[model samples]
Target: MGYDIMKNNNTKRLAVSLLLIFPLLVFGQKRVEAKADRLFQKRAYALAADEYEDLLKHNWNTAYAHKQLAFCYFETREFDKALPHLQEVLGNDDLPLRYIWEYALLLKAEGKIEESEKWLAYSKMIKLKNPLIPRLSQDSTWHPVALLERQEYKVEPVSFNSKYSDFGARIYNDTLYFTSSRKTPENNSNYSWYDEPYLDLYYIPLSSLDQTPKALEGGIRSKYHESSPTFFKDYKGKNSVFFTRNNLKSGQYVVGKKRINNLKIYKGEQKKNGTWDMSRDLAINSPDYSNAHPF
Candidate 1:
């Protein structure tokens, strides 16, 4: 009986070990296609291009792979590398309008004027509602034209600007709110795409520019990103705030294979106590799409 109990315990231990290591093993065993897709979704276009090329080397040539490879090269501005794949995908009947538009731009960049004009005309015809397409179609001659007049203005950096990325400044009444990725013990995790600390909402009094900025109170900041705060009068006529944050599920940010840290719009109300009472995510937010830069 004791021997049987000991064997059962050993089996449980082994099962636990496998459970712990399963994700890593799966990630390690991911195919080139899967890895390339994930990297593309994560906006790691350079790495994704390499994996896509690996797929091509293994004769995994498909329309989708070629299109994705072209997109990756296009995003990285490797126009020469992107040209052939773009041409390949353009031959397909079900090509998206954006791809055609990009291919047209690439042709123009490469000085293939006649070919570029053809693709540009096709793209314009496919997307008639897009105003830019009409302009491009009209102006088929692609050449750098110097601006006759330039407007220059003096700009100065804010006093509270830190060494880290500080941007997306907005003003509400006399308060100035902006996003920053300053290092803090609570926000130590680095954003993979930018290699920077997670952004947080910080504010200072516009009247008192010399004052140091402070992170907003009332649990407004999280371990993940919180940015682009916009204040407006809601239907209730109360001062309401809207900001962008990563979608959280079960008190944790959802992240895994084919899953990304998508941004959502969160609403907050200024309470009588001067602290914000943040509500759940707005109905407009979706885990699949990023909703940011609220006006």
Candidate 2:
């Protein structure tokens, strides 16, 4: 009936609880901070979570309790408990923007994609009404890459997406190319780690973003994976593409002596009919290690 996060198979939490109580004995507890805050500061999150939950039960400083409890659950990776408590904490206007980032990530983990993206976008707004640091440097001179972390940027979801995963977007010659794990007819394999479809390169026209992305085929697509594509508009009068793929031996995914298969780099040139022919394998690729994301 309580927030004892340590699993039933563990005895370490009992020892931690004893150790946590000794400090409260030595310090002569006077308030909730003396119990939960001290445990939180000591990084005893599993124990602190219980005390904060008790505070919630008693209706004492509920917001503070929610804040500490949410963090306690978060630190312990108890996201199911953390989400509701964190939602309460977000009501405070003074919450650090970092928590907003955390909430978005949690939402994404819960598969609430659109809401997660919305908060992710909202995180860039000015949280501080009056910032003290002046951003200008060297008599109003500025470089695009200078102090980029200090700059504000907005986030938005691209129209082309999968409920699975899609990222590593790059724009070349008015087309957007990226890696996606969405199922396609040619891509029948699955990456076992996440149980999702194997990745493949996909592209969409920048002119009509609302349309579904077209999967790149020919030698550029593979039965295993094709990702992180870099394009050259004119390589000897034909467009070229460089990408990463699983090591293939005689049209089968190759496994090394150690039973490890690694990604290798391949380059190809576009044909006059817009199909691609597999060119040469990059010499830099090694059978022992992975080579990916060629520029």
Candidate 3:
């Protein structure tokens, strides 16, 4: 599953993916900037990067353009390309704290450990909530050791996978539950960010591997995404189910022009007949941020 969700207005910091190409019209620089901004808003990082690069070539360079270009490359996993653009603007006071953290990560990815640690330390001074800071600090004095032996392992693909994205598998009792973005005849809506079908939970009995996977019933599967299913015994010793779903309030997940549908954790109680009654959203869920992968 995609780890980071982008927030609206370019204010909140997050991680990346996906890109597209756009044409450079014979127009003004401001028009190009506007088009780039629109593409970024639509989560088309590739096209946005192209537009921003065009703007820079025409001597319309600015901190915003460089920052957006860096983000576009970062989202596309072109860390080598993103590093220079991030460096171009990191010295600017107007740059957000999140980009500083990203700069440190880019350095680490490029094997510049000492430089990465320095930037990570500076980022921690700003009090940003990055998991890498503590981890790098703890492992600062650690060194790699040579291994004298190798372990043999066998790898094979599961036969029950479709062409679309299928992952996040978890086993509970005799059932194997997982998340998939495969399209079905009954539902064909695609998420604009990846142009893939929204995720849904599906399960197959472990004892009956030949049988086709079935979508969960009882309103557990919705039009939007429903993924990362987890099973546990509740405090009262009742069977409990926890999963991640888009923030829903008035039967709609997207709101206004931003198209925000932050993920939240949901809980379901097992009924006498074995069907789950998932009618409550846990208090730990937040409408503004995502809380996923409940174990």
User: Best candidate, TM-score-wise?
Assistant: 3
Error of 1 at 25 (Å): 20
Predicted candidate 3 versus true structure: per-residue lDDT over 56-83, tens digit per residue: 8877856778899888887765677888
Model 3 clashes, total count: 0
Model 1: worst 10 consecutive residues (lDDT sum): 142-151
Candidate 1: tens digits of C-alpha lDDT, residues 94-162: 887777877777666566768878877776566535667767655643322101112245677888888
TM-score of 1: 0.55
TM-score per model over all chains: 0.55, 0.50, 0.59
Better of 1 and 3 by TM-score: 3
Residue pairs in candidate 1 whose N, alpha carbon or C atoms collide under 3 angstroms: none
Q: Determine the C-alpha RMSD for candidate 3 after optimal superposition of all C-alphas.
A: 14.6
Score residue 234 of candidate 3 by CA lDDT: 89
Q: List residue ranges in candidate 3 displaced over 4 A.
A: 1-28, 38-63, 73-81, 87-97, 110-167, 183-188, 193-195, 207-214, 233-240, 254-260, 269-277, 283-292
Model 1 C-alpha RMSD to native? 12.5
